[model samples]
Each structure stands twice: as C-alpha cells, then as structure tokens.
Target: MTATTEINKIINEDNLVYKKTNLLLDNEMHYCPGCTHGVIHKVIAEVIDEMDIQNETIGVSPVGCSVLAYNYIDIDWQEAAHGRAPALATATSRLMPEKYVFTYQGDGDLASIGCAEIIHACNRGENIVVFFVNNAIYGMTGGQMAPTTLEGQVTATTPYGRNTALNGHTMKITEMIALLPGTRYVTRQSAETPAAVRKLKKAVRKAFENTTEKKGLSFIEIVGTCSSGWKLTPTQSNEWMKENMFPFYQLGTLKDE
Candidate 1:
C-alpha cells in the first residue's frame, strides 16, 4: 500500500484499540484520530508495568488533551489546574518522597502557561519527573497555536504560518529544563514507530527511576504528531515531523549523571 493508504489504515476505527499494555482504559480518549496521545499513554503504561511502579507511582495530570490521562494510567493519579502540574507534582513528590511522582502535560499546558511552574520546580531541584508532550499545536481547543509551534507552521491562530517575527520560534523545553540545577536527567524522544515507542518507554522509565532514586528532577519531552492539528494523515504527519522538526528539536538525552 502507498503512504496515503497506510495512513488511512492508521486512522481507521479498527486501528484505535488499546494496546495489550492497556495503557489507556475505558475512559473515552478526547484526542483526535491518529493523535499520538494514545501512543504516549502506552509508553507511560508500559513503563509503569515494567518497573512495577503502578502501586507506588502518582501522576499529576494537567489540563489539555492530557487532562484525561489520569483516567488511562492505572496508578494513583491527581488532576492539577491548568498549567500547574509541576507545582502539584512537586508537592506530591515532596510529601511522599518514597513514592514516584511525575506530571504529564502538553505543549500548551507546559511550555505556554506552565512555563514558570516547571522552571521553578526544576530550579528548586524538585524530586519529580516531567513528561512533556510537544506537538507544536494545541490538540485541545481545536488546533490553536502553542508556544512550541514552529515558525511557518499554520494553526488556528496562525493560519498564514507562524510568524517568527511575532510568535518566536518553538520553545525548547528539553534544553530549558536541562539547564535547571534541579534536573538530573533530560531526554527528548519520539513515538512514531515501534522502535521509537520502545525508546520512549525507556526514557519514561528512566525519568521515574530518577525520582524513585531520589536523584532530582527528571525531564522528558516527547516530540509527537498532532495529525488532526497538523492537517495531515498520520503517516504524512510522522514523516513531516521527522524531516522538518527533528533537525531543530533533535532527540536524545540532554543530561544524565
């Protein structure tokens, strides 16, 4: 089958079933078809399952598409107000030092509104892990431009291409977080393929380990596809991300020790 044909298959209703990993439960996913949120959820689930942290981990899910993440990951979960996942997570992590704590947030939720919280949390060397999903556009709220939306990328607010002169370039969270004295580990990965998904799961597990080991703040950014927001088929979105975005954002662990 051609690329478009494969993309159609990826978007077909039959393709949306939960992985045997069951990262996502019965709660309806608010994400669009071909959205990578499910894939990221799978990575979190697999890591939790692999590390046996389901009973000991608590996730602080923030507003945005990931607001429903707590419904998916079968662990002690808490919901934070918009852009406050890090603050809530910091409290939880400090209150229960023995428990693994992490926050899952989207580009808009993290880079745009939650920026100060995340930076301060990392600065204080908070013992928490952060899983940031950077898809450039706001998946919720109908594909609005997010803080990480690249220049020349169109969105609900930037239909004529994101004007770098006005909007600025995409925010580089991995780099930003790595600079914080509190952060001991940072990595950026993708989830477009099975191999990539496996790596992403490892990165998540590593983040959890940092908190569990009481090392310090750990940050992970998953460069994912917002198929519906980007106005492309799943396959095309994946390819576009690889060719156009990876060179700029790149992927790999930025800090670890």
Candidate 2:
C-alpha cells in the first residue's frame, strides 16, 4: 500500500483509541500555549458529546481569558459582561428549563467583580453548571492581583508580594460556595496530568448529569495554570501549581447532595 493509504487505514475507528469531540469546533484555540483553558474546554466538549446534549446545551462566557470560549465549543453561546455570566446563565436556565445551561468564568471575573452575581445565583438554587477556572492571579488583565491571589504571591499590582494586611487574604470562593444551601454539588479539580484530566472529566460529567436531573446548582472549580501570566514554561507552571496552588485550593469534591 502507498503511504497515504497506510495512514488512512491506521486512522480508522477500529484502530483509533481517541479523537476530538464533535462538540468542539476545529478552530485554532487562542489561549496561550500551556494554559489549562484548552484542556478544560476539551473536557467540557467531550462530556457534552458523550451525553448527546450538544443541541440542548447552551454556554455563557463572560469577559476574561475565557471570553472567546464560544469560538471553540460548537453549542450555542451567549457572551455576558464582565462578572455577569452567572446572572446571564441564571436567566437562560430559567427561561429554558429543559436545556442544559452553564457558565465559563475566570478567577478575576468570577471571584472578583462577579462575586455578588455568583453568590446570588447559587443562593437562589439556580439549576445550572458553573465552571470556575481559578488560576489565582488575573491572567487576562496583565497579571494583576486577584481576589484569589495567594498571600505573599507577586503580581503586577503586588510587585512586593501580596501582603495579608495590605491586600486581604486569598479568597477561597469554592469552599464558601459549598457552604451555601443552594449548591447540590461543589468540587475543586485540576487538569495537569492524564489521571487528573480523567478526574476532571468525571467531575464535569457528574455536574451535567445533575443538570439533567434538575438538581440545584453544580459548581466545578478548576484550579488551573496561567503560564503566560506566571512567566513560566508550561511544564514549570504545572509543577508550580501543584506545589503552591493545590496546597491552598486543594482538589476533589467539597460537597455533594
């Protein structure tokens, strides 16, 4: 056989172990190399595809590094104002109670300016999924100090390292949300390794399953990386995240009901 024929023969479904989900578009991603957004996006798409809910799913992505999420996911999407994705998602979920609705938000947008929006939405027990990607610092906005920035961590705004007295303690938003009565499922996950990615995928699938059952709000916090903002290579960023971020944010399910 010719080289092209041999390649095509090996690429058939019978031989293929894995492939990109159809729910994810073929467009080139714009996220910085090594950023966890792409991996998270893939996991979401895979869940939606596996559940065969692509047509019944809608995503809301607000201003942040994830603002362009709509460009990659094939499902219908709505762009919300900075920190307003939860509000928009709430409305969407209420208006179309049969459809699965979710919001993709970044730390700066969700933990900072969008704090009130998320709290109220969760407090009301809105039947929606909230994907909170917490990279600690503000990744899209010049690496500024964010609400979740680690104490004594350096950022553009905190060149001298974050001082507990001067900058307030790091916000553990996930834990705070877990305590709310409205949240039926709350978990913190990461996507750094093959095993970690599998866990993250399982968490997302569970969240979507909850949506199908009309359960209360499901919150998934992905403790992720921001290599560009952190000024480190992708490998180094992963190591740094496991060393620093995991100790504070931790991982695994915080609440399930």
Candidate 3:
C-alpha cells in the first residue's frame, strides 16, 4: 500500500470525533478562579474527542494544576512524579509506539524541575506530544517565581519584582526547544481569546499528526492566565496576558517538518 493510503486507512470518520459522547465529567476544576487550565483542558479534550483517540491514547499529567486532568479527559491517564512527565511519556511511548502518548505540564514542571527530562525527550526525538502551560508564575503553590516569569513581575517569592541581576532572566522554553532537531513541530499559543483558541486547536492537531507519522517530538507552549497569582479578576487576567505577555511571547507555529 502507498504511504498515503496506509496512513489514511487508520484515520477514518466512523471513529474520529465523539460528538455523541461527552468524554469530560462536570466536576469543578481545582484550578484557581480565572486560571486558564480549564480552557486548556477543554481544548485537549476536544482534540482527543475529535481525533477519536479516546480509547487508543495515553496521557501523562505532571505536577502543578495539571495533575488532576484525568478526571476531566475520560481517557486512560497516569500521573508522573513532581516533574517527570516527560520521562514518563518517553518510556510509555517507547513501549507502546502505536498508542498516542502525551504529557500535560506547567512551566514549573516543564521549564524547571523537568528541564532535563523534556530537553532529553526532545533531543532523543521521542514520538510524544507535550502540552506545556506557561502562566509566568507558579500558580499551584501560591504564585512563586518561575522560569517563564517576565522581568519586573511580582510574585510571592519575587515581592520586589523579578530582577535580571538577581533572578537572572525569564527563559523562552518553546523557542529554545524549537532549535532541537528532535522536534518535528513546535508552536506558541494562548487561550485568552476565542480567536486564539481556534488557532491553538490547529497546532494541537498538528502535534498529534507528528505522532501518527512517528516523526518526533511535538511541543506546544500555551500562554495562560493566573488570576489568583496576578491578583486580578478572570477577565482582567486574560487581558493582562494579551497586553503584556503576548507581544513578547507572541503566538504561531515555530516549525513543522
């Protein structure tokens, strides 16, 4: 069979998108009020539902707010230790190559504790998908300093604002990962606006496509909001992320191979 024909055989309409089935349960998300985790979770669920991978995929939840995502995704999931989701995903994907394995991690998990894990995963070209959330601060632990936090930003730990001289500088994880040969796809997106969410869905689908092709790593960094951490209402938080962060972080596909 031709490569195109063979690939098409596995992805047909009768089994994709579960419009008839609501995979997510309606439990109250533990994320702080106005946090973007809920929107990101829903986006992932929608993609999973649309792709019809509900029964054939595995998800790894890392530390921070993403740990409880299994409750909402309605799929087989595993929780990785503190910041080991990438390592866990690598092992799982290597063992079950046909099963779509993904990791949902935060800035603290992906850019900090799991730094080596994710970088290795990308360098090794593991056929895994990573849903990275960069909300600037460490939201789950009452808003502390994070690797992605912008300069002059105030958090519980950075009471006087982040100082380049003292705290170093914020790291751009997505752009850094894009430089790795292991990554077949890399993109930066946000959930601040409906228009942005629509664009994010396309990136999410491409990440899964990379996996189906057994290409390499797929990394998508989402600029999310932390209302509780930022001391702003939900609406205000979203606006702030757009105004102050989006220009620096921007949003778009970095590469596709």
Candidate 4:
C-alpha cells in the first residue's frame, strides 16, 4: 500500500467525536477567558447547525459584551440599542414569520435599560426566543452594578457591595416574564460544568423549536460568569457564581407550557 493511502486509511479508522460548528465564524471570540459567553455561543451554534436553521435564523444582538455577536454567529443578525433587542426581534419575527428569530442580551441591557421592552414583549406573546445572559455586573461598561446584581456584590458603582436597602432588591426578570400569559417556556441555566452545558444546549434547542411551534414566547436565562468584571480568575469566578449567584437566581425551568 502507498504511504498516502496508509495515512488516509488510519485517519478514517478514528471516528471524530467532536468538531467546531460552521455556524460560528473562524474568528477568535472576544470574550474574556473563563467567561461562559463563548460556551453559550457554541451551544447556540450547535443547535442551529443540528436544526439546520442557519439560513432561516435571524438573531438580534443587543448592546453589551455580546453586542459583537453578529461577528461570531454566522447567520442573519440585527443590532439593537441597549436593551431594545426584544423590540427588534418582535418586529423581525413578525415580518418573517417563517424564520427563527432570537435576541441575545446581557443583564445591563435586558434587565436594566430594556426591562420594559422584554416585559411587554413577553406579555404580548411575541413569537421570538430571548436569550438572557445574567452575569450580574455590567461587563462591557466596566464592572458596574446592574439590575440583577446580587445584594452585597461589589461592583464599580457599588464599591461597598450592593445594598438592597438603598438600591432595592435584585430583579428576577426571568421569573417575572415566566408568569406572563404570553410566555410558553422559561428556564434558568448555567454553563459552569459539562453537565450544565448539555442541559443548556437542550434548553436552547427547545427554545429554538418553540419558535416554530407558534409558541407565544420562549426565554432562556443563562446565569454566567464575568471573570474580569468580577475581579476573579475564570476558575474563581465559576466558584463565586455557584456560591453567590446560584443561591438567589436558582437553576431549572421556571415555567413551561
């Protein structure tokens, strides 16, 4: 046998278990090391690839760390103002009812400035999926405290840690939206572990599937870590998230219908 034929035979003997999805660009992601955004992006891309919806999928990228998502996800994308992704998604989905539309947003944009837009979109049963990334701090705009910032959590705006007595309590936007009649699915997940990644992928796939089922709305809240913003290494940030963020936010489905 020829050397080239031998090499090709050996390569074919090994089964490939994993490969990067083409739905994501070859460009290096801009997310900080230990950040879950990269993982979340991979999961979303995997789902899009598996569902064969890349050509039919439209994503709304909101102002935040993920504002550059359009650069990474190789699909139709629309940029929205800080916290206005839902509004844009609503319009896009309405105009192209056959396309799968989703919004990718962070805590600052979704829970703080764009809270009203999301709330009303859910209440109105907009046929769209909302991917809410809750890292608790304003990652893109320095480590500022956000609406979902945990009480006693230190941030640039809250140097001494968040004080509920003065700042009010953390906003549970996912829970609030789940209670709306227009919502069809709502789940809180994380990507801190291998098991969590699998669950997150399933949740995302379900959310995407719901868009085609004529569901009013689907919301997936990913409780993620911001290593730089939180002043912790990637490893330490995951530990901090588990110990701090999980207690209040909790995991699992808040609603499903």
- Estimate TM-scores for all models: 0.88, 0.91, 0.91, 0.91
> Over the stretch 61-158, how does candidate 3's per-residue lDDT look in tens digits?
97788788887777788899988999999999998999999999999888999999999899999999999999998888889999999999999999
Candidate 1 residue pairs that clash: 125-182
Q: Candidate 3 clash total?
A: 1
lDDT scores of the candidates, listed in order: 0.83, 0.91, 0.87, 0.90
Error of 2 at 222 (Å): 0.3
**Highest lDDT against the true fold, candidate:** 2
lDDT of 2 by residue, 90-201 (tens): 9999999999999999999999999999999999999999999999889987999999999888899999999999899899999999999999999999999999999999
Looking at model 2, the pairs that clash are none
lDDT of 1 by residue, 1-257 (tens): 11111122234555653223343466777777778888888778888777766667788988888887876666778899999999999889878888888899999999989889999998999988888988888988899999888889989999899998888877787798888788899899998888988888888887887776789988889898888889999889989999988988998989997
Task: Using lDDT as the measure, name the better of candidate 1 and candidate 2.
Answer: 2
| Candidate 2 to truth, TM | 0.91
In model 3, state the lDDT of residue 154: 93
Which scores higher on TM-score, 1 or 4? 4
CA lDDT for candidate 2: 0.91
**Candidate number with the higher lDDT (1 or 3):** 3
Q: Over the stretch 1-257, how does candidate 4's per-residue lDDT look in tens digits?
A: 11111112223455734333477777877889998889999999899989988778889998889887887778888899888999999999889999999999999999999989999999999999999999999998899999999999999999998999999999998989989999999999999999999999999999988988998799999999999999999999999999998999999999999
